[model samples]
Target: MKNRILSIDVLRGITICLMIVVNTPGSWSYVYAPLKHSEWHGCTPTDLVFPSFLFVVGLSMSISLKKLNRDNHRKIRNKLLKRGAVIFLIGLLLNWFPFYQTNIADLRIFGVLQRIALAFMLAGIVITLIQNTRSLILSLIALLLTHWSLLYFLGGTTPYDLESNISGTIDIWLLGSNHVYSGFGIPFDPEGLLGTLSSAAQVILGYLIGKNTLKHGKPGTKELNHLAVVSLSLIAVSLVWNFVYPINKPLWTGSYTLYTSGIITGFWAILIWVIDIGKKEKWTLPFKVFGQNPLASYVLSIIVVKLFIYVFKINGTTLYGWSFKHLFQRIFENHLASFMYALAFTFIIWLFAFWLYKKGKVIKI
Candidate 1:
């Protein structure tokens, strides 16, 4: 195995923590604006978390494949398939966890990890099989353009609109309305199958960028300069694309891919410079712990929260609400208490991650 890069681990760890914070709110109604996702048409800080995690998946895949014997192509391909399937399975189980809700028709099929699984699988196959850089770039372009065209032509009457888009239509048709997420007061699955195509493009883009980083082999001034130039160009292009397509995270628009990828590219560079190069890494442990076992951390966090809110209750009130009502909400205003609960939960999970980190256990799937 190749020596892992501290910067990638640190960057991914940052997203892992942010994801926990955003998802485990004391109350959805009490979230700070930045923590909340944009209603429909724009990007927010919370929007960055999912894409950034996907980008790390692509980067991590590239890193792993780079260490393998190139002549052993069959082995590499099989490993990719297994990893994707395992991750998908974990997501599926989490969606239907507790086993009490046995109604198969109502279980959510597309979710964060499910999307990660699909995107990583598609990205891995395309990036691995098409070794030619030019061909891979072309494939990436084809995916984005095709998705855009389909959204415009095939989406029912108001294609980009919330209720009538091609995404909601296709998912409701394929998965049945009962399976699609109804959280938004409509039948729309954010992590739906159709969006996987564009989402895969983001992963592919990360793989290509990561391949370049590997080619450079070490983080340095040269790496920082090139990344900055590339990021700026991408951001400019995304800004122009925004006028036409708009940067929508739920839809995972091509422009959103470009915009977030560009922003994170620069952010990744900074982390590389600060943590790996400058030797100023005294405070990077918590995030690195999260990165080491990101999927495990996320799955466990969700399960714990779900149990507290749904399955395990105290005196007929959910442990989740009961804590907020008596401990947090009773002390502070409702919103601040809600926010504190999220932070406390995040800290609790961090302790779990820290123990895993100390034990030197990194759960890959």
Candidate 2:
């Protein structure tokens, strides 16, 4: 059980590392196609990172819930709500960092951590209030199905189209185009309002998976086989679902959620089998460091990266650009150099994470 849980942490560590790598390319223009998100529909390696983190969050939540008493339902609910709000607010801080530099009304209202906080809180509430894997699973399906129906009916003729999707409309309607992400060359927040339903569903699925894992015996062939069977079943379902709705990370499409989470669940199953059952432990430290302080790592990575990206100039460019221009770009081709810069930046953050892990300073919320 201990080994299996450690494997979860390792998987989480791996996810955070990838998150850093994907988010911190030396130059967006130089990134490999795989490192970039899909233009509209379908999934990419980069797309998997956020969902994978949510999955790990679900698993972690399950483990944490075991420490709490369902008998103290009110207390548990309060703690979960407070934690979610704090994390969500922290994300808001990151979004608003270097504050007063930009208009407050024009600041982005939703972001990575905000989505995570909302999802975690909602999923935690559902799991706590219902207190059963079956109810969690049902709610997960209901959320996904509800999203599909909303997109199909309310999205006009081209419901899933990039520019015209209802999600972007809602962002403009509520937060306004100036306050939403302009990276798409349109006002679209990938982590938008209605998408929260599917995001929460991902966490709920993870919690149920974790709960089911505990109900089964310890980490062994039986658990592995069970996960494998479920993985295969879900892959089949997702593939079929894709034909009807398409798998899109931006919309948090139902098919995308199923396919990515299924594949990640299968991948983590192998990770557990190899690291836990196989008893291989040497290469696990760095990831454990990342997993130990995911929120701190996530928040710090964004804050520091944004600082490097925005402030401090050398040779008439941001420090990050200046570093890449002088260092990695000088040694490697554009694509590889861009990748190397991201990797180096990720490592720099990892060092701090390692320091925190060593000091037992895992920051929650």
List the candidates' TM-scores in order.
0.96, 0.96
Put down candidate 2 lDDT per residue, 282-309, tens digits, no spaces: 8899998998888889888998887887
Q: What is the Cα-based TM-score of model 1?
A: 0.96
Q: How do the residues 298-355 of candidate 1 rate in per-residue lDDT, one tens digit apiece?
A: 9989899889977988999999988888898878887788888988999999999999
Give stretches of model 2 more than 4 Å off: 1-4, 67-70, 216-218
Question: For model 2, how many clashes?
Answer: 0
Q: What is the lDDT of residue 229 in candidate 1?
A: 88
Identify the leading candidate in terms of lDDT. 2
